[model samples]
Structure formats: C-alpha cells, structure tokens
Target: MQLQELTGYGAAIVAGLVIGLAGGGGSILTVPIFVYLFRIEPVMATTYSLFVVGTTSLVGSVSHILRREVDFRSTATFAVPSFVSVFIARWFLVPAIPDPLLELDGFVLAKQDAILYFFAFVMLFAARGMIRSSEPKADKSAPAEPPRYGLLALDGLAVGLLTGTSGAGGGFLIVPMLVLLAKLPMHRAVATSMLIIAVNSFVGFLGDLHRNDLNWRFLLEFTLFSTGGILIGIYLAQFVAPMPLKRGFGWFVLVVAGYIIVQEILTSRSML
Candidate 1:
C-alpha cells in the first residue's frame, strides 16, 4: 500500500479508538484528518466522513444491541424526527441558502464553513453535556407518563439538521437529550445514542450518495481501521470504568473543538 494509504488507515484506527472510548468525539475527528492529514478537499472530506462515521456507528450499534444495552423504542423516537429534518435540510434548506454575492460583507460563507460551524456548535453542546452532572433517578421502570412527544420531536429535528449538514451522527447531541429529557440511564442512553447516530448517518449518506461526492478509497480505509480500534476500545471498557472515560472524553473533545475553531478562523481569514 502507498504511504498515504497507510497513514489514512492509521488515522482511522486512532479515530475509532476515540469513538469507542468516548462515543462521539472520535467520529468528529474524521473531517479534520481528511482535510489536514489526507489533503482531501473540504467538500469531499465531509462526504467521506459521513460514510466512515455511519459505517463505524452501525458496527458499534450492532455490538451494543447484542449486549442488550440498546433501547430501540427510544432510539426510534429521536431518530425518526431527526431523519425527517435532516432530509429536508440537506435537500432543500442547504441549497436555498444564497451564496455570497460580491455586494455582501467581504466575509462570504463557503459551504465548508457553514458545515464546520455547525459541527463546532454541536461539539460544544456535546462537551458541555458531558461535563454536566447527571442526577440519577431510581426509577428503572418506564415512566408512568410518556415524555412530551412534541419536545422530543423538536430535539430530533434540531439534531438531524446538524447531523445531515455536518456529517456527524448526532450521538453527542442525542445521548444528552436521551438522558436529560427522556430520563434514560447513562449506559442505555449511550447504546440508544449509537442507534440514533447510525440511522441519521445512513440517512445522510443517502443524500451524499445522490450528490455522488463519496470517496470510496478513504471510506473503506477509515472503516477497516476504525473497526479494529473499536474492538480494542470494547475490550478496554471491560477493565475501565465509564465515568473516568467520560471525563477524559470531554477534555479530548474540548481540545478538538479548539483546533476546529482555530482552523475555521484561519479559513475565514483567508477568505477575507
């Protein structure tokens, strides 16, 4: 294999390990690796990242399901609305946004910037959610009263729009919502989050497919390496407590967010 191919695969493994350990942060790294490390065009990298993240999340979800940790009903509740919103956003809203005309502020937004800004905002939200203390309630049984469907649907719609546009699974967004809003426990929330990510990612992938923007070589390499790393992560989970991992994951995400912000600043400046 070529040196670049090897590097890409190695990066994928690293990304997967992060995802397996922390849940959402690892997948978010895909775009950066593709753009900075692999020298992929920003537009194409976003598309590629979607496929890679979607596939990895699918595998992770299957494993979680096998362990009987996933809550399908809750996952569907979040994913269904998310899927609808993402489809509309990707197909309609995204296109409708006018490109910068010469008359506009010297700062014109590229499609890439729009996507990156969306990603950074989601990451910040996810990081904040991770750091917040969760007051665990003792109720194991399903709530006597169903949650507000309209509110959950709203969460799904917002998450889906970001996920479709940014190529993220919305796991970071969904996990917190499941726990805080749906009142699921942490582990179940994680498992259900994976399922929601998998569904939204697949839906996003379809939109990318229609655009014919996918880069198969990068996708395959990323999938293979990430899968290996995920296995390693799962094994490590057996020995490590999730709380420490969660804390560590939050810091790691913060670092990534900082880097993305700097990159965006540079990109935006260059456009000036």
Candidate 2:
C-alpha cells in the first residue's frame, strides 16, 4: 500500500482497538480521521463512518456470540425499537430540521456544523458515561426475568433515533443503560451493546444507501484494519483489567470533545 493508504489503515486499526477495548470513543474518532487525515468531506465522512462502525460492530458481535456473551433476547428487544427509531429519524426528522440560515456576525452555521455540534455534544455525554463507569455499582445481578418488553422497546427506539441521526453505534449510551437500568452485568452489557449497535448501524446504513455517496474503497480498508485491531483488542482484554481501559477511554473522549468544540467555534468565527 502507498504511504497514505498505510496511514489510513493504521488509523482504522487504532479506531477499532479503542472500540474493542472500551466501546465508544473509537467510533467517534472515525469522523475526525476521515475529515482531517483522509480529507473527506465531513458529511460524507459521517456516512462512511456509519458503515465502517456498523460492520466492525457486527464482527465484534459475532465474536461475543461465539463466546456465549451475547444476550439474544435483550438484543432483540433493543434492536427492534431502535430500528423503528432509525427509520423515523433518518426518513422524517432530519429532513424537517431546517438548516441554519442567518450567520451570527458572519458565523455561518452550515448543516455540517450543526451535525458536528451534535456530535460534540454526544461526545461530552459519552465522556460523562465513561467517568461514571469507573464508579462501583451497587447492583450486579442480571434481571431475574427478561426486561419488560415495553422498556426494551422504548430504549431501542431512543437508541435507534440517535444512531440514525448521528451515525453512531449507540454503545456509549446503551452500555450504561443496560447496566444501570436493565440490571445486567458489565460484560453482558458490552456484548449486548455490540449487538444493538450492529443492528442499528446496518439499518441506518440502508438509509444512507439511498443517497449513494459512500466511498467504498475507504470503507473497505477501514473495515479490514478495524477488524484486525478488534481481534488484537479482544486478545488483550483477556489479560488486562477493564478499569484502566475505562479511564483511558474517558480521557480520550474528553480530548475529542474539546477538539470538536474548538472546531465548531472556529467554524463559527470563520463564517463571521
């Protein structure tokens, strides 16, 4: 591969490792890598990231299933509503939100900026989740019975809407919810989160397919590298404890969130 291609592949591997090791920050980094490194347009990069993350998550889910870590019943409960939410958000809601028109002192708020802002906000939220994850949980028992179908459906719908709108896998949000609200163990939560992400990402990707603007070459390379990284990450997970990973992930998300906020501020000022 050429130098740039090698670098891109390396970046993808890093992204996958982060996701496999932790769960959220890795996918978030994909956008910045595409925009800054690969020089892809932000809008297109988001779509591409969706495909890469979705596919990678699917691979991870398979691994989890092989290990018998996945909760299929819970996954189904979450995936179903999430799928519906994705369809509604991608097809209806996003189209309805008018792009910002007037610039504040020439700070033009492009549609892309709006998307980035949303992404940054989500990153902040994810960071908060990572911080909270470091705290000891009082309850560690899986639900005696499967979660009430209605609650799972609601969670899935909310997760799906966010995934469709932001092109995220929703693991950051889902993992915590599964642990805190659904009373699942952390490892099971991670496995179940992967399944939910895989499903939602694929469904959301379908929506993007209608636009027909994906960069297939980049997507394929990203998936290949990320898959390799995930394999390495999984192996590493066997030896390392999760606490270090959680703290490292939290810090990384904080840095990314800061960078995104700065970029938005600069974009706004440039418009002025």
Candidate 3:
C-alpha cells in the first residue's frame, strides 16, 4: 500500500503495544496519529480514536480477564455514571457546541481548537501524575475496604466527561480513581480501566455515528493493526519493565502535549 497508510498501520501497532504493555496509554497516541500522520481533522480524528481505542482495549481487557486481573464488581460500579456521561457528552455536549465557541477582540476560539486544547490539557495532567508517581504503588499495609460506590460514581462521571469530550479512554483518570475510590490494587485498577474504556469509547463512538460519516475502511485496518500489536505486547509482557517504561512513556506524553498545544496556538494565530 501507500507509505502513509503503511505508517498509519505502524503507528497503530505502536499504540497497541503501549496499551497492551501499560494497560492504558495506547489511546493517547491515536488522535495524534490520525491528526499528524494521516492528516485527519481534529474533530474526526477524535471520533476515529474512540473506535480504535475502544476495540484495542477490548482485546487487551480480554487477556486481563483470562488472567483474572479484572475486578468485575468494581468495574460495574465505576462504569455506571461513566457510561451515562460519555454517551451524553458525545451525543449532546459535543454537537451542541457551536463553531467559534468564543470570540474576543482580535482573537477567536474555534470549536475544534477548544476540543484539542482540552485534550492537550488532559494529557499534561495525566503525564504529571505518571511522572510524579514513577510507579503505581498500592498501600498493601492495610486491607482495601469495599468500594465506596458514591465516590466511584462521581469519579466515573468526571472521567466520562473527559472521555466523551476528547474521544479518549481516559485510563489515566480511571486507573487512579479505581485505586483511590474503589480501593483496588494498582494492577487490578489498570486492568479494570481497560474494560471501562472499551465500554465508554464504544458508547462515545455511537454518538459520533449520528453526526459524522465514518471511513470504515481505514478504521478497521488501523484497529486490526492495533490488535496485532496488543498480541505482540502480550507476548512481550514477560520481558517488560514497568517503572522505567512508565517514566519514558510519561515523558513522551509530555512532549506530545506540548506539541499539540503549540501547534494549535500557532494555527489559531495565523487564522487571526
């Protein structure tokens, strides 16, 4: 095939490896691949990202499920509000946002730009958490109590808003919420977030279906490549190291966030 398409597939594989290895970071790479590599528009790139992220996550989650790493009760509790919020965000909140969302003297904020800025901000926030921790540590000194359903529901709602608006799985948000609110161990938290992301992303994709014309040919191919990468990652898991990998991934995320923000600002300036 053409070079761009080949690179797109390669990108999907790398993204999937991230997901498979880390259990969540893969989706963060999807939008950038679509936007910069494939030259898809930001709005549509997010839509496609939901499909790629959701499906690849489903595959990854299945491996975790077979290994019994997934916590079903906690996943269900966190998913309730998250599911609802993501659907609403995609179906209503996103579309209702008018283009040129803001206008001021000599400056204007387009809807696409706003969405991207929100995405970049989320990435930076997530990167900060990862960088600060260096590694996910659960306090095993004390037994984890039963999940506080109320806090889980609230956290899910907020995470759903982030996922729906940005077409991100928001694993960075979900994993921590699972640990803190659901009292899950770090490993279980990551595994459970995969299932939640699969659900939330597909629901968000459904919302996009009503508003956008999908390029199914591209989506399927990209997802398939990503799925293959997940398989490779699963095989490579025995050799993977978490701490250094997480640190490196966090730095990569920070750089990407900076790039997106700078690109948007420069583009907007030119428009003005």
Candidate 4:
C-alpha cells in the first residue's frame, strides 16, 4: 500500500531474481534489504531473511528437481549436519548473546550493530568469490561419484555456522564445496545448494518463532513476490548472459558491503 512497503517487496523480488539467475547472490542481499529498506533490527532482519531465502530457494530447487539435477544422497549428507548446526546456532548461540555486545572505556557496541558488521564482513567474502569465480569446466570424463561423506559433513557444519550467524544461505560457499569436495557436477551442485539452503534457513527460522514476534503477513507477501521473480528470472535466463550479470552484481555487492561497514562505524561513533 505504502511506498516503503512496496520498495521492500520490490527488493525481495530482485533478491529472488538474483538467486534464480546467479544461484548464489540472492540470500546475500536479503538482510541488507530488511535492515536498510524495511528498517528492521539486525537480529530480526536475519530471522526474516531466513524465511525469505528459504522459501525462494525452495521454489528454485523444484525446477532443478524436475530437470533431474538434484542429488538426494549428497543432499542428505550435507544438509543433515547443516540443519543441526543452524538449529543450535539459532536456538542457542543467537539468543544467548547479550545486548550491548561489547563495551570498552568509551565505546558500547549494541548486539544488533555487531551482527550487522559481521554480516558485512561475510558479504565482502561472498562478493570477492563471486567476482573472481570462474565457471566450472564441464564434467566430461565420467559420472560424478559422490565425494567423501566426512568431508561433506565437515563443510556442512562450517557453512551452517556461517549461515546462522549472517542470516545468509552461503550458496557462494556451498556451490564450490559441492563441486570441489562433494564431486558433484556443477548443475547438480547448484541445485543441491538450493535444497540445503532451504532446509537450513527455514529450520533456523523455527528457532526464531519463540525468540521474536514476527510479522508473518509481511513475510508471506515478500516471499510471494520473490517466488514470482524467480519464475521471471528463469524465463529471462534464456536470453540474458549470466557472466556479465554476475560480475556486475558482484561489484554492486562490494559497494553495498562497503556502505554497511562505513554506516556501522558512523552509527557507533554517533551513539557515543
């Protein structure tokens, strides 16, 4: 109804399109949208982000499933541990953190601001990976045998911690692990990452249900737009070039990350 709400919804749509087309950057932007555009507190923004990213990725994963690109065995190995890690992080670690997270002689850092700063740090890493990421060479030799279960589980744990802390799906992190560690073909890796994100995110969201009072109506509306955007992005992929889009979007992410760092610093100083 109002302009601000519309912008938030529009941001959700754009986020979904990015995920659908780029397969990794969508969830990366959700918190920034919620924090800056929707003016949500960082902790709650992360909670909302999990829902948005999870549902959007779920829709995207369905197409991969239909195309026979999902690897269920591998998905199970990776996702199970990730789910545990995220649940613990959400249900325990996040809530256990004290507000005014850090205090020094003359400085006091709020928990929400600390979380935003950490999210920005993760954003920089994701952007760098995206900009420097080379498309994987086509798998031409033989069928991809599933990689070591131990290694996949280890990666899952690490990524789950990263996702729960940052409220990001960590697809940028997941895709490479799937290919390099799990030995999945690139297509299957992308698809599997989506499912893993969906599970980690929504399950993490459940931990937030009792932690905060959420506006479900708003979340559902945002998610609906994101789903629509994913469909449009899938259709547009037929004509659009992914490389140029990804590289350009990577630069945009970098700029946004810079802004967050600077913004947090200023907010810290202003509070003094």
Worst 10 residues of 3 by lDDT: 130-139
Instruction: Give TM per candidate.
Output: 0.84, 0.89, 0.93, 0.93
Please give the lDDT score for candidate 3. Answer: 0.84
Q: Candidate 2 or 3, higher TM-score?
A: 3
> 192 in model 3: Cα distance from truth in Å?
1.4
Per-residue lDDT of candidate 2, residues 1-272 (tens digit):
67776777788898788677765457877777777678776667777877888888888778889989887878887888899898787777766767773467545677777877888888788777776676346534744554466776787888888888877777877877776566677788887787788788888777778786666776887898987887777677778776678767877888878998897797666756
The segments of candidate 3 whose C-alpha lies over 4 angstroms from its true place after superposition are: 134-144
Higher-ranked by TM-score: 1 or 3: 3
Model 1's TM-score against the true structure: 0.84
Candidate 1: tens digits of C-alpha lDDT, residues 168-225: 7766667667877776777778777767877887777777677665667657867888
lDDT of each candidate versus the true structure? 0.73, 0.76, 0.84, 0.86
Per-residue lDDT value at 64 in model 1: 84
For model 4, the superposed segments whose C-alpha errors exceed 4 Å read: 138-146
lDDT for model 4, on a 0 to 1 scale? 0.86
Every model: Cα RMSD to truth = 3.1, 2.7, 1.8, 2.0
| Candidate 2, poorest ten consecutive residues by summed lDDT | 135-144
lDDT for 10 (candidate 1): 85
lDDT of 4 at 76: 90
Clashes of 3: 0
Candidate 1's displacement at residue 188, Å, is 1.5
